[model samples]
Target: MNKWEILNHAETACYQEEREVLVRGDRRWITALHYAFQDDNYLYLAMDYCVGGDLLTLLGKFGDHIPEEMAQFYLAEIVMAIDSVHKLGYVHRDIKPDNILLTADGHVKLGDFGSCLRLQEDGMVHSSLAVGTPDYLSPEILRALESREGYGPECDWWALGICAFEMLFGSTPFYAESLPETYGKILHFQEHFEFPPLAAAVSAEGRSLIQGLICEPQERLGAGGALDFWGHPFFSGVHWATLHHCTPPYQPTVSNGTDTSNFDVVDDCLSRMEALSGMRGSQPAGAHLAFVGYSYMATGETKDCSRDTVMSTDKQQSGDSEGLIRDNLLTESVSEELPKPFEHHLVLSKGPAGHVHGDDTDLDAAMTMELHRQLQEAEQRSRGLEEEIRQLQGELESLRARRLTELNIHEPHLFLPAHRLDATGDGKLAPPACHYPLVIRLHRHLLLFHRVWRPGVTGESYLLVCAAGVELQAWSRQQSAELS
Candidate 1:
């Protein structure tokens, strides 16, 4: 398979993870997943059609900001949605305006659980990858990657704070031109975070809510679940028992259930990019066993059995004497063509006084001898075919191993001097120091590399490589140039 096909498989796996989370149940705030199935090289998820579009689109409709009242209405529902996920022992690492989908009635339904991870017994999850939007990523997430520590559901609340900030103001609080700068601002948000004078109209209560959510993990809101937000000043008048029944501050203008007017349309073509590691070949045997229990039919629903029902009805309609005679004749003809193992026991002809004919006895003996010879020949052919198949399988395995070795040898990596290896944490080999020009291009499915540089905040040069639609950090320059 090509790189794009491999990426498509990775996306399919992520959708499978999302399906697992969505199949929990039909909650008011969570999007409903109706069914999931896989076709050739593709996985399909049938979910709720949110005709009203998403919060990001809604933000665009309002010129990038919304009133405090509207923000409160949506924020409350989002809290409930996120709380529902936490109750199921999963942390939604990716929570932003784009994922908070709107219905035709404009109420929020949280979607996209692809970045979700189940919490451990200690109510925390440990992962090194920063798996969410850079603008809204929590400081703890980035810290965990370097510190090798664990983070809990508070990360989602921090994203909620980012969403609230964007809604009140026009953009995320820690957004910067570069990812490192944004991450630096988030790590030290106490100094970097502040409300702009343009958003002076925001109420004290709304500002307090944002502050509570965006604080340190121990002090963040919703630690004790949705109950923690019940008495908050921003949600003072919200009916906790019947929030879904309350009227929304804004209603979407959708003419039908499948309207695409509220969403931005983009070209559906796949982009050219390198495939991810460990996903370039055919999956191992029994790989499909992972999804054995994934197929589900909801309660009170019945599976379609139209094919079986039609076959049964047809049999009943054709239950006539002529049909029975025809079936019997077919069975008899088949039996006559193929020799039975016990055919020698039957004496087909007898003399007038019930004595067996000598000719019939001789014919039965000859037929038995011929059958034995044919059976031995068939067994010999089967053995030969099995031996040939085993040899072919051995050759196939050897080819796969050799191909993998070649790929590893040809894979691109930055060559750094031995002294620079100490710069990495844990005393392991590291990429070269930053401030070198690096260029990456894909030609004939092979990655071509060159050095490039960008100035960093520390007044040092840094290397950044754009590959597979993601910016990757590369090591510094080396005196000896090596292409392999």
Candidate 2:
């Protein structure tokens, strides 16, 4: 029941083990350091230990707003570290200030992967059990526990955006009275910032980069897509390759620089990640790939798809801290309420062949302000109505799917919502009642299966129904009750 002791022991063990493992890079550079014990309740982690301590401690000493130069250096370093971890095919699910450590020599060392998992291997959507600090969590993460079974690399990028925002501003963009409220704000995409301070301090391009990083996963940059964001105008003069080469940007706070007493355990633990990365490509020929879903491209496969063109249906949104979907009007309304510099701009590409879009600059500043106010009020009203409509639509879809799956109906046209039969006593003809009734049919040739889900008035329901398997006979609740 006492978690403090457990946490302290785990934290100490992780710190100690990481101190000893130095091959090409330290534990900070090693994202997944798997260490288990004979007892196996908690695993020891030998990760990179920066002498300066975590970002939380640093913030306490110097306040939340970091120096611009230091912030840029720290942000850039973290981005590269993230790139390395993701390349190895994993996501550091819990990214926050407390996880980032500053070495004695003034360089940033990203640590803590206790919540880390091989994102490519473990396909999750979101978790109900909250992990990591609230302020630093992505909108999706904040809502889902770290266990939800479907998010991809975009989740990590969302966390990185929060980190960057915290580095520049003393406060987080999203916060509320309670965790549930905070989650609601994130789900609704309600985030705001003051212009006078952060705007005065950071560059236009730097702000743009932040916007790109914080958006919805579909809107946010991908792991490989991140390189382009880093190479943008914000970091025009910065050299990333040279920076990554520096083993230690600053001196480690540990007094003895040559300390190797703990190296064996650390090195042993770090090697597991190396083994995992190596083994990923060595699957047996014609290996059966598990089908999680079609949305996640890496997990599921389609026969006609080309390697490069197996594009994902979901597009990540930029500036989304929680990795949740935003109302299109929320951004527009917020942009109108804010000043010109704070206005949201579409990150469109140039050239005849590229994505080109025009800015609404023809209207005078005064007229624009008036238009913005009108738009915000109108959007707020529209979003409220839209939310109700969406909820109703979702409920209707769920009812239809449940009816089709439960009855094992094979008619594709019957699945259509518009044509769906109203079975709610609205004078609709009820099917002839019979014993063991409700015929079901499915394509046995289609071996593929997907997890079936239904949300009810009480809570969500889940059933892993097979694509080919249909329930031929139903033992109704009345029959079961009579048997009992």
Candidate lDDT values, in order: 0.68, 0.48
RMSD of each: 27.8, 20.4
Q: Which is the leading candidate under TM-score?
A: 1
Give the winner by lDDT: 1
TM-score of model 1 vs. true structure? 0.58
TM-score of each: 0.58, 0.45
Q: Write candidate 1's Cα lDDT for 1-484 as tens digits.
A: 2323534455323444576688883346677766676533444566667767899999999999998889888998898889888878888889999899986566778998878888999899888888889999999999998998999999999999999999999899999999999999999999999998885699888899899988999999988777567667777656544456456798676544456888875667355544333543755555445555656544433222212222332343456232331233233322232223323433223334533333235544665677798899999999999999999999999999987664423223444232232344455543433433233322223344344433453333233333441222222222223352
**Which whole-number lDDT from 0 to 100 does residue 257 have in model 1?**
44
Q: In model 2, how large is the Cα lDDT of residue 344?
A: 44
* Tens-digit per-residue lDDT, 426-460, candidate 2: 64433322111223344343232232223333322
C-alpha RMSD between model 2 and the true structure: 20.4
Runs with alpha carbons beyond 4 Å of true place in candidate 1: 1-16, 269-283, 301-484
